[model samples]
Target: MNESNGHFRPDKWRIYFIYLIAAVLFAVAGGRLFYLSVVKKDFLQNQGEIRAVRTVSIPATRGMILDRNGEPLAVSTPTWTIIANPRKLWELEQDPNAKTTPQTEMDRLAKVTGLGRSWLQEKFEVNRNKAFMYLRRQIPPQDADEIMAANVVGVSKRKEYKRFYPSGEVTSHVVGFTNIDDAGQEGLELAYQSSLQGTPGKRSYLKDLKGNEILRIGQDVSEHPGENIELSIDLRLQYLAYRELKAAVTQNRAASASAVILDVKTGEILAMVNQPSYNPNDRSNIEYDQLRNRAVIDLFEPGSTMKPFTISAALRSGQYTTESIIDTHPGYLRFGRQTIRDLGNYGKIDLETVLVKSSNVATSKITLSLPQDTVWNLDYELGIGSPVGIGFPGESTGVLPSRPKWHPAEIATLSYGYGLSVSALQLAQAYMVLANDGYKVPVTLLKQELPLDGRQVLPPRVAKSVVKMLESVVERGSGKRARIPGYRVAGKTGTVHRVGSKGYEYDQYNAIFAGIAPASDPRLAMVVIVNDPKGRKYYGGEVAAPVFSRVMEGALTTLNITPDLPEGLREVRLEPKVPYRLAQGG
Candidate 1:
């Protein structure tokens, strides 16, 4: 009886100890639950939410570039980009029994998307460890749809924007092109890239266990669309000028060519063209030389076309008059060690006759007698040796040697356009000074609202006399080929030897013509340049003047300018000249 009683007492003590331990554990668990649910509840909830939410960037649409007449020059079109979940692709690769390998997937993608298999393979290999990767960007909607329908594992399609140039090569130099990422690359695109590129916005949302967007946990942010740009280019005129310039380059077998048409009164760039142009849509076949926009980028000695400036400057300085005579007998003048000669010998002649005959000797004598300040100051005012502020990416500030840098012969050479350089655009703008009542208006490419005030660069009487002389050039001088039957055209011809690595190449000449139509009341100022024409008649009158005539005629007609030619006059013919071989250094 004593032994059984002792055993029961021990068992009861053990039961009491077990109950005490259980009570302590229950209180500790209650305290922990209170701390987590009440004290740190907001922090714990935020941590869980962050793990489930993701923010994504939404790209905005790029701006459109339009011509002055509301024609589309450059625009953006909706496209698609192919993305991949690299982790999912890796998982498939790890499965030995999987039907496809990463290489096979890439090959399939390349076949459907017209991309190289090697390129896709490299991209896939680089992002094998990443969860998301871009397989291709700027894909057309049709191609994107095909890829989507194929049900390729780990692949997704996102909408994007791609640039579209409807005018193609015709407007390439003016409107420019954009890159694959929808960023502006050249021309106006490069000039206004910041204003044309839109701002991207962010979007955050919650996804469920299956990765489906369930609820909108964040506000929808709005994106800022890019501002549209209106240019001063006229699409119809631009096309006409491009076609005519291209025909001239091909017919003359020229190494290159360029043209620019400006509104005399408004200083608006109506059309600009360059030969050996590239199709922005198919950049794969583009050559570096063909990509050059020669109208604004190239500078060359203007030859006889620059004669008017010297004569104008002399007239403005009261040093010479339209009837002032210069003795040009012997057709040449010796200055220091250099002797300058004219294209042909002329005796004593007035300014008008000098211009009509384009006598280099006469011009050299006149410019040399003038003050150095007159020459330098006149060039600066006419926009030479300076930017035109046309808002282009690669405009050249043509070289006009400073006064101190001028040699005795330099002034003579510059008088007839051999020692200095000027762009086709600058030439056109300078001519506009004579066309617009002796005022030099600032050139612009944008569609401005108000008319720009003109700065007087020459006297009205002097400008009128210069215009008459220019008319005589077209009517009876070397620029006769530039005449249009139904219009009164005034211009000058320039045939200058091209400077090479060693010296001037004799047969490699730049044939150019700068002109304004309806001399009585000029409207369009056009400058045409044909470089290194391989033809027997490599003169500006033979190679470039005819092109100017045709382009100007067409452009003026398209713009509905009234005809101002004298009755009974007929359009000049453009007969192809015999091809000439390029000579060595002149």
Candidate 2:
């Protein structure tokens, strides 16, 4: 030790060494801070985001399907989807430190979500290794909220929608149904799926360990809701038609039935219905065949209904008129080996009587006398063998065979509506031509503000003549049962033998009735088809005509259509005269 300024001092080298060590330590710490802040910033941020950040989906609302009068047919209801991180759920359940026991927790979940406990447990075990799984989809929002309040670990609720049918089975075939994910499955729903479906949005959110949202970041994409659609169907008329058709089907014990009514002026379908329908809200008990829209899909021979077109063709040819005479002697006509016959000997009948009695032989003779393409060409111009073009799914263009050479049997059968097939919709459309005074209006299921210009498929005079002749059919002919009280109804009856695997099945038949109302000023066109009715009554007049009458009656009243029949001609409900004793008691 050396004494300086009367005090003992340590070595200078020791002080210098301590200062150098401190400087070195500060340099290392500064370099590490710079590297972390500049070189590895994005990697660390991404890792943290993976743990606490999530991309959440924002559900958009689906559009509503409304009837012509603004009545709701199909709608979307707010709902939630229950999902789970299965691995995390299993871990929490197995943890001895959990707040609730596994059995009790699962039981609570089952009760709240309406799921069986055993089923949930099995699903959990099956997906134990999956990071995500659906527990229950399209559950009611209230139930989902209740589940969320239970604080089940690794459980989450997502926004979703469930489709609801307001009219239930009444509009089932028209409005159709959606899947659990709010996607349209059939009918108009499937036809307009692209417009009916909405675009989902996305956003980033920060969630807590318990799967609860802590904060929501900015939205990455905007949600686009579906467009609302208005259909041409009138709910009032639809209900009436559905009720009458169902009653007819049940009473006749038919295999199936369909009915369609149109606004003649606008070519708008006012009501369409099919029997053997299913409830859109519940599909668990539904059959595949019940989902079909028979009015637009099923095809069958149009029977005597095609006679009006043939008669119109004849009138257009200037060779025949309403006063023209047709020889149907012996009630039958022979074409080679095939024979066309009538129910009775309607011999030497006039043009009107051919339709009045629905004489097949008379129609065959008239069709044979005319040019080869007369009837077929008229039928083609009347929208036969063509689609209605309403964008309906599975719409059929009923078979209209085009042959280079016509056989005598084919010509004979074609004259009586046997060689070609037509849907109820197509038949109705053809009748629309007669009702619209020779103009062929475009058919649609969408509401129209004004009447559209129609194509002139037939001459106005010929159409009017045919329509006038058709009035005699309901006045005294085969479609007598289709008469509506106080209304001058013009219609035709058709009874077709169903074709089986071999040929025509004699025991089975398709009973059809197509008609127009208020003959003085046509406003409505309707077609009814009852397939394979059992028992003594299977004719179009007895089966399908009655349904047309009942439905047309209610529809006329509902639409406030003016009655054309005179007061004296209108049917009166007679009441028996009260006796003197009964009058005294009253």
Candidate 3:
């Protein structure tokens, strides 16, 4: 070693160079330490939290769908969804020597969840790369408990809900059901989905080394439960309608049928039911055909049920009266190439008699005499060719002539309930106007404590006149069979030809009866429609009117209304009352 001066000293440049290198290294290390402990401290903590934190849902129960009397029509039951960590399942599959191989674990799941083994395996294989997967949806809680007891690795259960329709196929078309995720698919459920669905809550917490997710869970937010829906439907009436309609359908071998009941005072739908209903609870083999709420969604030519409205239009013009005489003697009238005929001529009868007879010739004479716009305006006022606004899903606004222009033949056809279409709901609403003394009440599925404000349609006198004519119909006219024993029922029969691609299919008819009961003081209006009955008798009076009679009888008796007919004249019915029940828990 060379001395700096006289002695052997360490090399000065080498010493300086080593000191410089050491200082640079110290600065670099210090800067890195500062960056880690100060600048990036929050970032690192968040990373750690992200690894340990868990998210959880605070499930909210869906709302109950209750009838007007608070009977549960649709209810949500506690259930569980089978979930799994596919990544973990795949990891288990890769290990041939593992005690719980993926197949073994899946077999246990399949057994508990009632899923096929092949399905489980195929699903798992397809989702091998996925971190999460839904194995099954809406299993009974007990089933989930049994599955959880098995402790299949990577598999778990999450709390959820399932919709159960206690009324089953009876109220299936009205109350409807929900999907696996609990979304409404049809009927009132679909119509009031936003209000019926509840908000899901959230929770977050940190995980410990034991992997105990339950212990680590902490609430971050609370869930809001859904609001209960009180529908205008009367469960008793619904059952009655459903039972009778089903009976008629089976007896007559009809394609389908629909029945609706309305409160005359408030315009609330008392009951609505349809045939060809699907079970919402068991949708394994659901066909789209069985899902329609035919009462609200199906449109048909209303035929003679529309005659009362035509009478209203005529009387509204002040040019006609109930006693005004019309000659239907020839029993037919020629308009262009079309001939409007009566079932049989009633000689020369009053205008009211025309409706009672459902005479195509007489009603046409009266309608053709009226101003064209006046007839169309009457239809518009009656909620025809429009939504009744009962808030049903896929509700039909039935087809009407796009323009005001009506050919002479078209006007004649319109007079006799042709060249225009209407839904059963529209028919019901129009009858409500007659029942409410010419007040066109807004039809609603929701219950109202008092009758809501409605536009005055016809004069009270005209409305009473029409009702009188309808009473005549039930008394001795085509709708005679619809008469209730203790009640003076007023209604009309409609047997319209079903229109097809080529033209009207005369052989295929929609039999319908529209009536308001207790003619002494109106309370209920009902409509019954039987589609394409293949029986020997296809008249509305024969098919649809009978259903109306039974339903009105039951409803009247159930509501305990006093007999409006003379004491000795009240007819006796022997039908047993059906009980309403709640959804059964498994």
Candidate 4:
């Protein structure tokens, strides 16, 4: 009977059972807490971010291209892109189930955005299934501000940059331009892309469901501005050269023309321009033909412009002097049943006259005397058949025929610039060597500090001697038309027939003039080439020399280069339309 309370014994173990139940419940919760805090943390955090936070690309500004004088050639201006999260905006307008339909909302978007309702609707329809779309890119900031003020849901604004060329087509071939994405497409813009394009940055921030920022998360990464590049271009000289080249090209009815000016002492490219230049800002209409930097990319036989190098090579051999005479009783030289002709018989001319008159015969005689290796080596040293190392993209190496042996005919043609080709820049570099007292400096489009110590390509005495002869060519020979008042110009005229599919096209020619200004102590070297003139005349002296003179005159004046000639000297004006037959471009 005392055991009658057997069921009553439950109270004795009830506290332990309660403790056991509590312990099991606690253990289950701890496991769940661990899973939530550790194993599933990343996935949950990502899901939260997907619903609330947004990441966007930050655009970095491209650098400004400046002239050495601190003039802006290419610059980046702030622009805005109108963007929309179509799905978000659609949902925002639809959640209330309001009277406004998606089309009505889009029309309102177009009206506020200044875009036609049709365009807006079409744009929205194309991407209605998607979340993001660009409404319009590169609109003015004022327009973007107007759109922002319209309180259009899901329509957002982003900042970007657009490249502008202050000089436009005038510097198109040198300063170049960028594409719609702000990447360099041509000229120096492409060459210095890495140095000019800055790194973009990012930021993370807390935002509301409406996509409004509540607070910034962590430190905002700052965007680094692109480095400013000061180029060697002198805008004044660039424009002057461009105008004259354009005029000559138009007047001559030429297919194209190119010109380059260099600071001979520094080996800096002061100006480089080409005809048919396109506006870098207008990329959509640009033709493939107008995209090349012709001065550095296009190659043509330099004709008589190549003669000076031949003379320099010969003089270096110690076997010839500027006064060394080469007999030419006949007007041409015959080698292996091939004849090399002069404009006429430049009979018994000295080496100086060989260059002064650009006598193919005399040059051939001198060239054949030097070892083929000597000639090629000299040419290579001057940068012929090689890139001028200006960092221009697609720069031509030209065509230098390599052989252990050369036929007398090959030597003859090469001496006078046929059977070889060179870019206009290469021609300028070669002339710079002659102008810089036989030192060949690495040419550059960047401002150089005293120029890399030049390689001695020719004896200084020999280079000076050739410069003197070039002075003669400008003062009295074929380059007379290139003479600028108060500046003793030294230059050679070249009119070489363009080699065609069949051979030389007799009527088509490349008229060229390569020159050094203030010949007494040369400070500038320039080259001008007019290709395939359709006008009545096409001679280097007539077409190219005058362009050189006009450009050089402006350059000398703009740079305030002291006049070497007497103050009273006046420029000799030559008629533009005259039939001036001077030394043929080789």
Among all candidates shown, the one with the greatest TM-score = 4
Candidate 4 C-alpha lDDT tens digits along 1-586 = 2348655465657888999999999999999999988999999899998777766567888889999899999889999998887777666555786556676667678788778888777777678767788888998999899988876777888899988888889998888887788888788888889989999888777778756778776776778889999989899899898998999889989999999999989999999999989887777888899988899999999888888888888889998976788997687777767777776776788887787767877887787877777778898888877777777888899988888778788877888888889999999999999999998888888887677777888999999999998888887687878888888888898988888899988779899999998888899999999999999778888789889988999999998889888772574754443343333323
Clashing pairs in 2: none
Candidate 4's C-alpha runs over 4 A off are 1-36, 39-44, 92-94, 97-99, 209-212, 571-586
Q: Candidate 3 regions off by >4 Å?
A: 1-48, 89-123, 208-220, 345-347, 402-404, 568-586
Clashes of each: 0, 0, 3, 6
lDDT of 3: 0.83
Candidates ranked by TM-score, best first?
4, 3, 2, 1
| Model 2 misplaced stretches (Cα beyond 4 Å) | 1-52, 93-104, 207-214, 220-222, 572-586
- How many backbone overlaps does candidate 2 show? 0
Tell me the whole-model lDDT of each prediction, alpha carbons only.
0.84, 0.85, 0.83, 0.84
Per-residue lDDT for 1-586 in model 1, tens only? Answer: 2466664556777799999999999999999999989998998988888778767778888888999988988888899999887667767767889998776776677777777878877777788777688878888898899988877767888888888998999999887788888888888888899999989878888976434467776687877888899998999989998998888888888989999999998899989999989888889987778767889999998988988888898999998877799999887788776677665568889998888888878877888898866766887899989988887888899998886656758787778787789999999999988899798888998876775987898888989899999998887787888888889889998888899999898658999999999788999899999999996668888888889988888988888888886573764654453332221000
lDDT of 2 by residue, 543-565 (tens): 89889989998999999999998
lDDT of 4: 0.84
Ten-residue segment with the worst summed lDDT in candidate 3?
577-586
Measured against the true structure, the TM-scores of the candidates, in listed sequence, are: 0.86, 0.87, 0.88, 0.91
State candidate 3's TM-score: 0.88
Report how far residue 557 has shifted in candidate 4, in Å: 1.4
lDDT of 3 by residue, 1-586 (tens): 4554556455777799899999999999999999988999999878887778777787888899999999999998888888987778768656778777787888888887788999989898899887688987888877778888988888888888888888898888888888888898888888889999999899887765433464555447888989999989899999898999999999999999999999988999999999888888899999999999999998898887877888889999999877799988888888666666766657899977787667888877787888877777888888888888877778899876756577777777777677788888888988988998988888888879987888898899999988988888877676767877767889998887777899978688788999998887888899999999999777787889889999999999998878788552466333321221100000
Better of 2 and 3 by TM-score: 3
